[model samples]
Target: MSDERSLATDRRGAAAHPQLCAGRRARLAEAMARLGGGVAVLPTAPERQRNSDNDHPFRHCSHFHYLTGFDEPQAWLLLEADGRSTLLCREKNLEREIWDGHRVGPAAAPAALGVHEAHPVDALDKIATDKLANAPAVWFPFGVHEGLQARIDGWLATLRERERLGVQPPQAQRDLTPVLAEMRLLKDEHELGTMRRAARISAQAHARAMRFSAAHFRSTQGRGLPEYMIEAELLHEFRRHGAQSPAYGSIVAAGANACVLHYAAGDAELRPGELCLIDAGCELDGYASDITRTFPADGSFSAAQRELYDVVLAAQEAAIAATRPGARKQDAHWAAVRVLAQGMLDSGLLNRDKVGDVESVIDSGAYRAFYMHGTGHWLGRDVHDVGEYLSLDEAPVEQPDGMGGRVVKRPSRVLQPGMVVTIEPGLYVRPAEGVPERFWHIGIRIEDDAVITDNGCELISRDVPVAPREIEALMRG
Candidate 1:
């Protein structure tokens, strides 16, 4: 694997980069102000033991991290609509720190994290109850964390009990997710920069995997290459580029394995003539980038492979073109569907006489036999990032019946500036009656991370080759 560390230099230094939690907390507090001023408690993910003695790798909750960049477990953030913030976290214990790891602890959290006050985790109940008393509303993620609802219930009960002492309890309860989700949907400048670096690193990783597959195939004398080897190449490139980890499970599907969307079982052997579809990406500084590329294991695509690859590529291109401000998110998927449906018809994969035109095929969903999934999804802190696809208004979707058909409702979230999404269009062809035998067992998906702009969209992962000739040349070179 190459020692290229393109992303290493781009990473912001830890000391130079404060968590910026102060600004984020202020913004969230402003949003919470509309709720008539209350207390909000957000907790980070709890550490779980992987086994009897060992603990699993700890990751902060996305919502929690969005509010506070604090990464430690056993931590809760208390936000007040009046612009005060408190961090309830673990207290320092030298004995525990020696065996486990260092913690900022309650003592330095206020100064280090830019909060107004800090307390030990044990004081959360008392503090939350006191804060909730006489407040108009209490807000938290309603059903996300297990037992969290019960905890809030207990707090409310405590407040109710104190009502006889002239203390008023919170009158309303609200879920804070919608406000936070909307805030997170539009990427800020810092987030975009981080996501762009993530895309580049992930794109380079894909190229590295392709090169590794090519070399491994040649070295093995056309026998085969294990899927895990290609996956390893992706991992090597990711970590070498300073990524903490892959954004999600690396899908290194070889041959028929590619047909299974979300396939991560990397036990299959990639044959020389087979197409390897690798859907992988990495996370950098809490942002994520997802990219998928399919290429021939032996450095070049076969005739059938090239044909299917072109169709998916064209579909992805149409999806990318449709990704612009003011356009609905579904517009990209429909664009990709139209292109893929036409291509399938032209290639004799779908009979025109039965499936009719692209519109009819789409209405009947006959194309789903080969192309089953959506064109893309929102990509951000999480691979399937949070954001509302639908507005409060309901729009009528005319069904094929022309009279009474199901309303065509999908995530109608309009494309907006700073919104990033994946434009991935794929065809997973399995052997079936009326399906072409040559196209059987062929799964081709072309994916690229796209950021919606005022004029159109920008392809962040454009560094990776998408064209057949370009991929072949890169492998041969």
Candidate 2:
């Protein structure tokens, strides 16, 4: 994609880019002070495998960056409220630097990250044990850090052995995720700015896909294009417009393939009379924006295609209108479901024997045949984002066998200020053995990136057309 210079702000120094990095230090210190005493371990993300002799781009973990803005890998940021944050990183490695990139070496980390002390990464065990001597707790998120977990376990084993001599260890291990997640949920000024740029970059790519696809259709207008070609055009546009990379794989599903919710293979060929559904996003400075649109393959929608498209579009609008701070996210999902089911009933797709009432039919799982996926998901660092739906004291969700587990097909918890999420409601009718021929294959989805605010939520991706007339005009252009 294009370089991030346009969207990039003045990040030359910590003083200049103080909001996400510098400001986070203050908040984290505040949290540490409140907890009495603890040693917080924040590890940088690991290098991801691509293939032999190659690796994917390295991205710093958000939590690590939050406390200490150091982006270097293999670093451990240890925070002690009273003392300084100790940054542990690999020292200068001449051989690896030649293969990879420049190194910020251990010596410079203290000054760069505003830390009081710094050391080589190999010293993690000794330092952690020494700091935790008088601490009642050791804080870190538990699930994703295997190596760190093992290190802590090993250290704890040694301390427990020392207990024979009347030595005490850290009284408890605390989960720091709640504190971090709460802080992230409320986007500061810098985060909102980054999100706006991310949405703009992705919007340009979406518009490019529309303009280019229409042009391709107009010329041999019916020459036909493969689903994968459309997919490539979108990928190119995103990068060309300044996205670091796609937030997720684009779903360029054509005809029946659109019925598959997360379809990413993108191998179908577009027919003259069919629909192409694209669900894609772009990442800017680690922030993400998600957008999905469905349009005619031949530049004009068929009657059935338009019908299903309108139903999905209406559902999206309903969901968008219901979004506001403090409103439970389930409100929008249920509202969209009500509108969608009513449209289906009017289309003769639902009956008394099949679905009882149009208003309540969706929650009964009657809509799965046509709408398999949830209406939306939280969007940020990761596609699903890093946060919990339930409060800190609430019990984790549980399910019996044969039922979709905790993370599957559940409504989002609530809409809160500074939270960014995707609002996408869709409908699909694939031809089936017992179904009528008229409803052969139709799929449509309209997604928007939204930011929740105090007064109301902001629609970050309104640039793309969603209305019937507007979409037609966009295609004509």
Candidate 3:
């Protein structure tokens, strides 16, 4: 596999655009060194069949790709405590290449991927068994792959059988998810660059959808496009800007359909006075950007729509303002909840008699009637990235039976620079008793990707307009 085409060599003997991948591996190795010495194995995602002969699009496992920049399926990475990295993958085969595509197989993987060693993927079980014997600890995310777990179990059993020969299995088994997740939680400069690009492309896609809705609402022949057409416009913009795919399912909700949180766009017809809510984003270079925008299909908002839309927008603004370094993770959420609760009271969506003041409404859980979902989540390689929110504060204050307890002091994590989070505040009102008829069937959500900075936060999706006037003007144009 050591073809001239495989090596990304330059005049100075440095690989081109290698910082993002190579630097990440170096950092992970450093982190591994900090932990007790051992060998950790990570495998890429496996391909799944879509039908009898076809396969779904392959996506590399986020953790595996973070450690080793190999994107191909059926590949495994090994991290030794001595800062050595090895890759085990399918060997290059010209016959397979003729039918499928090119493969930078094991022969050239070391030079191509900057790994210390490379071997055929078929040898993984044997190699792994040898590496696992007499180890202080074996770090791997358990339950991810049953096959890998079985292999580990086999190695341990074999080592146990070799007790007469003085061979010993690993002393302890540690879960690697927490360690890798903590590393991934903080974005480096390279990850941030990719995320910014993803956000920009996603924002452009939303703008395209808005304009497409306005132009296709009513044609000269009096024919209108369905909700799926607007969804197509979003896909077009995303691909045009080089996005690999949408971060998640594109929600193109029209009319009452907007009230559905994860509405899937279909043949639903777009009406003139109905509000369209699109929650779509693009994934670029493995990073994900999430955004949502709500606007009228006819290029102008109705009075009732504007009233509800403004509330959601204000809530999102309050949430974004509270997303800064040193602020608790729940601070932004609570800020958004307070604003939305107040908006609900003002709009008569929540009755003062039963809901009482905003504080009482929040405490009594009355606000769940309208705002049910969380304001936002951690955003990164995966749409909903992994990172624990709770910090070790104190033990829970339980009842005398020690059941149905409440935490006396539960501390949330403080925001830090390089953390990217979403600020999505929404109001989904269904037809119910005590709800105003004017605001019924109205669902408005305003979301933006915010990157925490030293002073405040930066909204990467700011290019897409969220204000009513700006959305209308963009649609009109």
Considering every candidate listed, which one attains the maximal TM-score?
1
Clashing pairs in 1: 389-413
Q: Give lDDT tens digits, candidate 3, residues 301-378.
A: 999899888888888888988999999788888899899889889989998887699878777768888888888899
**Clash counts for the predictions, in order:** 1, 3, 0
TM-score of 2: 0.88
Index of the highest-lDDT prediction = 1
After superposition, the stretches of candidate 2 with alpha carbons farther than 4 Å from their true spots are 1-19, 160-167, 391-414, 433-436
Worst 10 residues of 2 by lDDT: 399-408
lDDT of 1 by residue, 1-477 (tens): 232555688576222244565777788888889657788888988898999999988878888877767788999988989989888989999999998799999888877777889999999999999888888888898889998989999999998998889998889998988888888899877888889999999999999988888888778798778888888888998898899899999999999999999899467899988999999999987788999999999998989999989999899888888899989888898899889989999988999998799878877887888888888898899999998877546665543331214466543778899999999999999888998899999999988999888899989997889999999998987
TM-score of every candidate relative to the true structure = 0.95, 0.88, 0.92
Model 3: ten consecutive residues of lowest lDDT: 5-14
Q: How far is 102's C-alpha from truth in model 2 (Å)?
A: 1.5
Worst 10 residues of 1 by lDDT: 397-406
Model 1: residues >4 Å from true position, as ranges?
1-5, 13-19, 393-405, 408-411
**Model 1, TM vs. native:** 0.95
